[model samples]
Target: MTIPVKNTMDKKQAITAAIVVPLIICAAASVYFFVGSLEEEHEDNQTIVIVTIVPQQEFVEKVGGDKVRITVMVPPGASPHTYEPTPGIMKEVTKAEMYAKVGSGVEFENNLMEKIISNNRNMNIVDCSEGITKMGNDPHIWNSPVNAKIMVENICNGLVKIDPDNADYYTQNKDNYLEELDTLDKYIHHKLDGFSNRVFMTYHPSFGYFAKEYNLTQLAVEYGGKEPTPQVIQDSIDESTRYNLRYVFVAPQFAAEPCKTIARAIGGETASMDPLARNYTSNMKQIADSLALEFEE
Candidate 1:
């Protein structure tokens, strides 16, 4: 018994529908899963990190690579001694999974630590200055490459704690950055080697740690974090004369008038030096170069 042409056509259409419907459903399911996976990957790839200064931001970027989103509390040209965070910054802090504090008793940290902890109760707080030798309450621990090595170690530990899956990546990056820092240390030493004058002058006492590291003395025009008195200015002039210093280092965060005056009094020039610079290696090298210029025999 032969089937009619219409009957055969109906059977063929039914078979095609059965095969295509399942295939279309499978394709849609695959697409859904692919999109969901991409979203999950994107979420897993990034972490929100908070830092108190630009240098700390650099450290985080070095170790965290593309995995971190940094929010620096102390912007460039603003002294950490007097920085006040806005409500928006606090809101950003609340969203951060980690807060890498300078942790060396900077005035801003002293004032904002409580609020920062309150804002993000569960955020991991990493003290970047944990093992560094303090300079009589000096908070510029990152100034010394030796101290910076410790800070980077602390930063890496904090990163590993929060993101264990990426621990190896963080460790590798930390190692690489540390090697660079070591090279920086050696370069500074090489530049300042065999120098006649080991003393340098600055507007602010920002380079105490750097001075300590390189066996140099940093004389500041400012005293007790205050503007120079007439006597202090005279004293600085006398010291500059005595040391025969050729340059006075001025930072962008502070007024340069005092440094310029002292420099002029001693017939020297004022040079810009930023200890809070974001480019860690280059900043140190530049500082070394500036000091080298003054100390050239």
Candidate 2:
């Protein structure tokens, strides 16, 4: 009787395990697959953003976080002033939900905005320079942290427009970035506060807005976006000599022809300064530090 009872009990346990173990594993697998599918769907649904410049890429990424996939029209080591978006770059417009343009006379935007829209009329346009008073035709608006904050707000607004569900997330990221930019502005002010000579000479006049923000004068060896002519070089040398400026800044994208020549004439040296730098905050700090070196001396 005991043996028959034990055998019956063992059969019952085996049948339960055969049914319940498979059921539990199937349920767990279904949940895992469901969650994985949802994650894949979410990733597949990310908003496509096309930006005109490298810094715009940063601005959009900071605000958009994982909600947006960005394509920068002007790649690094390329000047937006003279860059044209290739057909391949324009193709991105087809999928883009938004286009964040450095709309302040950036040659790339000015040249291709219409074509970009033509490719995708549904694409929302976000002007990064929306709130700032543009310094004439200068496209270097993001050079100033104050202007950068405005750009970031504009970017956040665009992200919200494209992905309203994540508006709060975009807004929070923008707030954090704005705080960092404010700190950067204060740090630059503190670093350059007591400098008597507020003049900086560069190969390109890319820092006009930044110089204006910080009460500094930006002298350019490259005149009117062209390599400096003889007279322009002489004038730049004279200007730097007047301010006792010690360094002439040049970027990787532009020819340093007159920068070095002017530096030699003015008894200074040519140094690197990229206004279109992707690492905006750190680049600005580097700029401040470079200026501080010259100013401190």
Query: Among these predicted structures, which one has the highest lDDT?
Result: 1
Q: On residues 68-168, what C-alpha lDDT tens digit does candidate 1 reach at each position? A: 88999988889998889888998998889999999998999999899899988999999998888798877888999999999999999999999999999
Per-residue alpha-carbon lDDT of candidate 2 for residues 1-297, written as tens digits (9 for 90 to 100)? 699999999999999999999999999999999999999899779999998888777788888888788998889999876787778887888989998888798887777789889999999899888989987777889899999999999889988987898989999999999999999999999999897877788888888988999999887776566656789778888888888888988888998877888888888898898887888899999999988877766
* RMSD (CA, Å), each prediction: 7.0, 5.9
Q: After superposition, how far is residue 228 of candidate 1 from its true place, in Å?
A: 1.1
Runs off by more than 4 Å, candidate 2: 1-42
Report the number of clashing residue pairs per model. Answer: 0, 0
Checking candidate 2 for backbone clashes, the offending pairs are none
Residue 38 displacement in candidate 1 (angstroms):
7.3
TM-score of each: 0.85, 0.85
Model 2 — TM-score against the truth? 0.85
Q: After superposition, how far is residue 256 of candidate 1 from its true place, in Å?
A: 0.8
- Candidate 2 lowest-lDDT run of ten: 220-229
